[model samples]
Target: MPSKRVRYPFQVLALCLSAWGLAWAGPPAEKDKAPDAASIRRGKYLATIGVCEACHTPPAVPAVPGGGDPDRERLFRMDPDWVRYLDPQRQLAGGVPFILRLSGTTHGLVVTPNLTPDVETGLGSWTEDEIVEVLRTARRKDGRVLFTFPPHSFYNHMALEDARSLARYLKSLPPIRNPIQPRTLPFEPQPMVADGPARAPQGRTRERATYLMGALVGCRECHSHHENGTLVEFAGGSPSDPFQGSFRLGPDLPLRQLEKGFAAFPYPGFAVLYGSNLTVLGHGGALERVPTERIVRAIRQGIDVREDEYGRPRPIAHVMMWQFYKDMADVDALALADYLKTLTPVANPVGVRLKLFGTDWEAAFQQTYGEPPTPEDRAAFGMP
Candidate 1:
């Protein structure tokens, strides 16, 4: 019998296709599995702790005028209820612009994006893999870099699994079609603020805490002081409580003397609250003195401390929602505490920096707010 020519059809086809600059087509790749309910729920909780709404939610229709300008308002009016009761539909459909003012000059702008799942406007087009890419690399799916969000730094310390959990959760949100315009802004560049060394530094516990406190829990907003004239302010806490007469010694107090001592003012000038000097370590700051248990309580359940508003108490100056952080993992809480202890003890007091140093409120209005707002203007802003 003649030798049979064994036909290697598959091999020959592969070779031919390779030579022709293409591979034989195979079945279409499978899509990623959708996140389960459990994952989505987990992500929702994480988002809350991160205070994602602070930068993401469109500013509420203020009871005051000028609601059109979202930037000219306190974050969620510093109202714990306002933040907690955000509209679910518009939640994460971001268009809020956060302006960082220092010494009376606009230092930078941070306008967030809509995080909803809307196909045309939000994260609906995103996959979990893209989420992972952002948390890990700070790069967009299309190859652009993300802005310097608090998450951008600490998430680098997060576990892939946790990052995945966050991604899964975000992807699972109900789609909303709110169109957020371009979020970038034109402002003076500020120096990069490093989150400092890892808060945990040892086990799976390491980095987890700092991510929550420094990035997620958001204490740095209230628990910090500016160096070389940086704006130092926090949500839900104001120093000068006009109602209670608790106006503390600060720059805008009495004579606009630019005195430092943890200064803060609500939008539209409702109240001026001061943040506690957090970097001093022992006397007032809890870092070297307070027990971890107490610190944890303060983080999860608010303390009963009070600030003065015209010499009367007004719900601790502004509403602080520690309950949102109730479910923090134990390891993460410890991590947050550890990070808190590591805040390089800055002896300086907290104060807001305005454009014209040592100028009175009237000049400040023209220099900072433009054309001194009247009592109606202030009330219209719902701050006073």
Candidate 2:
């Protein structure tokens, strides 16, 4: 004998609203709001400087009628056509595979995902907060951790505003219907915390440069020395003292030994490349010897024009990500160069085995340096 429950009129109204998928949550959070025009523009600028398109956009085939495969290569590449351009239709619709290698071992390939706003295939369902979280933590909501390819480590503590703007820009893109496969890791990705609090850059030029190189552009990922595994926080470094250089692909031998000479690298024909010392500490450091104009040229042109022992400019190895920086604005590139002159010096002499230009690199190199290397020049660099 239970009294019949009496529902209030308000409760009935609430039930009706819930049934209609219109439950009142007061108001949508700021993160859920549609971005304004200024916000979208700022986001686009940030994405361009971050070179998101370099890794996210698939390449276009010049000869193909309709077009070629979308996911053929990762990063920018020189096709048989010798001209490289991102497919406008598939912009940021990532489907390329980035091979993950350690020392000489191949772990697996990490496929880039569609960043467009496609409801089913891309990030359309993701909230701005979710996108910001991935930028700040390198860990997605699904628990998958991104390593290296995205350089999320450097982006982990970027200014909150900049990160949010970047997210807004990504969400504003036209929805592309590319579906990306999930990545399988050879080892578990460890959870990461920022080395320090997330601090916004001050108005000073060096501070802005710090935020630009360390966070947005990720110059430190390759230039700084790392301890533990490749996924750990950079060791013995701070924002102002990045660029200490690493031995991962460097010649570990002393200067004299390197001069006395060593055999060709273990990987026959492959260049032994390393992040060169950009600080003003060692004999090989760029700050002391290289002019700021030269640094700007290197950043914009990809050729280290600092004459080698052979009295010729060296074409930086492809791994340097110079292609991404080629389009950087002059003011920012100059700021980065000027800032490098003020770094706390760290003595790390790097031995970079320059790569010989191949037929594939012919047109691209010509476009950059005005012409391809002469036959004698190729033989001088040990290319057959």
Candidate 3:
């Protein structure tokens, strides 16, 4: 037995050593690693701050099946809805069908485009770099740069990490394959006032103005009104009926109404109340018709261009006019004006009459005046 064991091993040992050497070599260096779960969650939170859902998620009705029922656990789960309304063939397609009364007559319901990851119709093909570039530069595929993109600018003040997280969250969304039509503006193209040499700022001034107007000041939020009378995120214009000069300011109308009343009756006289157009032109298409110098004067001095029977400059009754904006310097106002010039014109055909003196107004006035009228003792009160 000892003699046999000694003879069998020499060649076998060399073979075993060669096999072990091959086993030690590992996989190639080019393989990718999976994304971390933690990162995905962070991205989701960032997306909320960026308010992506406000645009992507279709508005739901109170009792409707897919309407946004606040009580529902999956309130903004857009995937299933996208598949329902959007064309199945289109990648990641989804839209909200909404009837926007631009004015009383000029109205139509259009779908707000879906932003999903379907390769054919969604953003499945877009790179992270492209998303970042679009937000930063406001350039579309055709090389036209837009000044604003709604709630995205709300996150303009967000940290870089937050922005990246939002981008990642957007990527994680299921791609819907619906191609959206380009948003149309009502007016003809005009050169941006900011681009002109007269009022253009240089170096730091330009950069500072851009940052303030785009992010901090949020001038666009009030300036842009949507077709449906909604404030279009960073888009300019108040949701004003261009013809009627009235729109909802959510629940803040009392303060404005009081201010208007005070301005109208500075000495207890009825004053005509007018709402600002918020367009580059002052209200009543004056900005479009008047010269820049005149526009500046109206904004600074609260002068109304339209005259009464006497042809005197109508006492500027719009109390809120230039008053709030007056605090801003000439340069700042001009910068704001420059920013306003780029707004996409939405045709807000004047809607129905907005009763400024409604029950609420009467109630407020009564509170200030005191005592309800009494019907008793008509003769005693000199009735006949």
Model 3 worst lDDT run, 10 consecutive residues:
7-16
Off by over 4 Å in 1: 1-31, 34-38, 59-80, 99-110, 149-154, 184-207, 226-274, 279-291, 304-323, 329-331, 338-346, 349-384
What's the count of clashing pairs in each model shown? 30, 0, 24
lDDT of 2 by residue, 210-287 (tens): 778767876665565533324222122222221222211111100110121111111112122345556652234434
What does the lDDT read for residue 372 in candidate 1? 54
TM-score between model 3 and native: 0.34
Q: Model 3 off-target regions past 4 Å? A: 1-33, 60-94, 97-111, 141-149, 153-157, 186-384
User: Could you tell which candidate, 1 or 3, scores higher by TM-score?
Assistant: 1
lDDT of all predictions, in order shown? 0.44, 0.51, 0.35
Best by lDDT: 2
Q: Show where candidate 2 strays beyond 4 Å.
A: 1-28, 31-34, 61-83, 102-106, 147-150, 194-199, 202-204, 225-269, 280-290, 303-317, 326-331, 344-352, 355-384
Q: Model 1, 336: alpha-carbon shift in Å?
A: 3.0
* CA shift of 264, model 2, Å: 20
- Candidate 3, residues 1-384, lDDT tens digits: the string is 011000000000000001111111122221133443444465553333222433344333222433444443132222212112212233224443322223222222233445566676555766554554454444434455433323333333533333343445567766655565454322222112121121112222455456544433334443334456454433232223221232221111111101112111111222123244446353343245555555455555556545658977754433222433344445544554554444444444333212243324323222222232133212111122
Model 1: per-residue Cα lDDT at residue 48: 63
